[model samples]
Target: MTLKATKTWFLRLLPVVLFFICYYCSQIYFDSYGSSGKSPKTTVSLCDINSSQRKWSSLHLNTSRHPELFLKLEDFFWREHLSNHSLPYGIKGSELLLLKVLAVVTSYSMPGNVESSLDCRTCVVIGNSFTVKNSSLGEIINKYNVVIRLNDAPVRGFEEDVGNKTTLRLFYPESASYNPGKHNDPDTLLVLVPFKQQDLLWLKEILYNEKRVRKGFWKPPPQIWLGRFSQIRVLDPYFLHLTASNLLKIPLNPRRQQKPVHPTTGILAVFVALNYCDVVHLAGFGYPENRNQQQPIHYYGQDTMKSMKNSFHDLNLEARVLKRLEEQGVILHLHS
Candidate 1:
């Protein structure tokens, strides 16, 4: 071949070689710094895929009945500047850390139409109330399409009353189950209810195993979380905000002399289920009518109502809300 012909071939392939090299380098850079740097634009598109798959029934369409349930990826960055004195139920200084967590955790959405009836999606929120001990409600609870349980509740020995299936188990870092496998099914989505900035930090550390934080929690959190990263979900603070602000009519940030109030995990679970499921049910959700009586608050533990005196939640107010909901047929309260 002529020398000029060889030079022509080299010129033709130069652009192709450069293109491949650039592509490889970009992939490496993104894989390393994607979560730490600016939040990904793909977050919005990912949530949009399943955001509006189901339409609210006529009952839920009533303005008074429904509230925005889940927080989209856009919520973290766009709304960070908003005033959120209610630290536990709002994102303020922890937006970037939360973005990192969101990048790794899975987005939860309802499954696509599997049933013939559109309004057939049923959910049961199982509380830890002691009344459920001998309820024999296990079979009935398992029949629902979604069974949501709260904070570290055991299901192994009490399966006869609480059922074995768990679609979503909502808990905070301190309340997370040590034996997650024994309490939750393999596919159960573990939802985190971040009450403070440290909660988000705990999730990030446990999910990535980057660092261990020993302080900032009311109770010690699990040093080693046994659940899979894919199963972890950050419950949108919007539901907590709604329950506190709208349902309970509590102030987000009260005056210095006023005590701070927040919704309990059980109430938050009900609000979460309301937006996602067509039919919502409650089990094991009432305090003893006679506070003077010596009755345990939870089915599994010996903790009594006296333990609730210094609690951030108002059990009496929450009970009133639940009773109204039951009377309105917004939720079915099951008695075992």
Candidate 2:
């Protein structure tokens, strides 16, 4: 045969030859080892060391066969430990002993596994709505270590808004008012949740109103508000206080600040509490969970017509997020 013809014949047989070589190598590997050299899974399995000695030998085989397999397995387990949900501290004012017992029971009983420790607990309560007024949520609200409130959240006529308690009050400078009387105390934990870039200017305008300050509406100066909170903390603005899915970005509704005003701020506070707190009991947040529940969904002093419709949406969001976190063993939702 000519050289060209011979080359063609070799090319046609090359694939078949390579296939057999691979097949033979695989057979040799399996027959000599008797098992694949892979690490065991995390699940517990029953086995007798004596009876399964041969099986173990085959499974381990030569270290060279699965070089980093053991290390990789260890890494996997370590990741799980790092991601495991564990709260070291109790909610807040409640006795740590109460949480310790509950933590022990819930860790094993809950659907998802949780680390047994009360040290990781954190609670953030967010709404600035008038809904909390006079409902007597203050004593309960004070139980949380971290309390986050939004713009113009005051405890004056709306006793529930202030809850007679506040750890952190986040608001735009513009929304803060000192007209008739200072709604919040100088000692109150105040945070500035900025909105429009211009809103900061508006905040400054309100806070820095020398006239208002002299009128006794603001006992502490504008510089004083910043000075006081600066000593405490400035939490990241986007640090959601709850479980919000990153799967989809919630679009900002045009009328969000207008009608159907669902309070993302309120929902976020509860969400944060779920991730970090062990036993989360809500207050002032109305009963949209069941229509038959005695309490109305909103705090009393609200513009009943406008706030009622919007408040329901916010309440629903809270209920849904609470349900999901409960399933994850992150929190025990106390729905009253």
Candidate 3:
């Protein structure tokens, strides 16, 4: 064969070769790091994760926290999404309808295999912060393999900056609302991050009995507003714990009186992409230490501070983690 023919054949076969290479390396990581019970936590730096510094091997591995998975009521609700806090795992909290709802929803899960793919995928995780307001990342943000938005923020008016596309939108019970005015992409995934059992129950009522849950609304207030175009997935509680323990590596200091908070929606979403995608990008996520601390948290809203002052969610710690990951070249961090 001519040299040109050889080059063409090699290029055509390259994807198949890369897939096996990635698969073989992944098995190694799962064996040595996972089953041996060695520390998954690493003080990674950009120098370490950069492909030029090494190879794609740094990106593949068993960042998967555990081999076994759990998805049952008595098992699931016990896992904490809130800061070291758990929900009362019984039906005694003042409603029976809620109990019936759990019995149904708890049976469904996102499934470990559902998010996996053999091809390379890029993901962009969008946070609700003012840093994104005028950064003009909308066009770039929408082009990723997947785009995830936290809670609910407006995309219509801010499309130039925040991007009008959303692949996934995550909502906790308190933050979960069906925005009547915002654009809802029919294919977007509505993921409910269960802070408590009530959040799960509330989601069920809204999606199923839209009218009875709320009166005379054309669509349920914030429930089933997506209609036929969307679906719901609850974040696994165990996965939430792993990001805190492994990635964020929350300080173990006992002298600190306040308990460490659970991972924020933004961080959890980043970890989700890391598990599934070949590369991940984080936009509008830096702390305002260099700017006014009292500025708005989101570009779309002036009703909040640049960074919240609360123990429920440790915004400061999260900033540091993302910075370290960026330095390590694990993620492309867009803080402007």
Best by lDDT: 1
Number of clashing pairs per prediction, in order:
0, 21, 9
Q: Higher-TM-score candidate among 1 and 3?
A: 1
Q: After TM-score superposition, what is the CA distance of residue 91 in candidate 2 from its true location, in Å?
A: 32
- Against the reference, the lDDT scores of all candidates come to 0.76, 0.38, 0.60
- Report the lDDT tens digits of candidate 3 across residue range 1-336: 999999999999999999999999998987777555343111111122245223234534335324222234454434333334343212223234444544555334433333464254567788877778788777777666677888767678888887887877776755655552355466566676665554655666665664434443322335554433135555555566566667676642325776656678888888776765566778877556534656666777564543365435777788887777777777876543
**Candidate 2 ranges beyond 4 A from true positions:** 1-137, 150-163, 173-186, 204-235, 240-249, 252-263, 272-280, 287-297, 308-318, 327-329, 332-336
lDDT per residue as tens, model 1, 1-336: 999999999999999999999999999888776555333222211222122333223234333433334445666653633555445767767778888887777664432332234544677899999989899988778877779999999899999898898988999988988768888888787888989988889888887888788899888999898988767777777677767877788988789999888899999998888776666788999998655557788989788878777888888899998887776767777766
Report the Cα lDDT for candidate 2. Answer: 0.38
Question: Looking at candidate 1, what is the lDDT of residue 273?
Answer: 81
**Decoy 2 TM-score against native:** 0.41
Q: Each model's TM-score?
A: 0.76, 0.41, 0.63
* Candidates ranked, most accurate by lDDT first: 1, 3, 2
Which pairs clash in the backbone of model 3?
45-328, 46-327, 46-328, 129-297, 129-298, 130-297, 130-298, 178-222, 295-306
Query: Top model by TM-score, which number?
Result: 1
Which window of 10 residues has the lowest lDDT sum in candidate 3?
Answer: 40-49
lDDT of 2 by residue, 186-238 (tens): 44544433333333333333434423322222223233243331212222223
lDDT of 2 at 251: 26
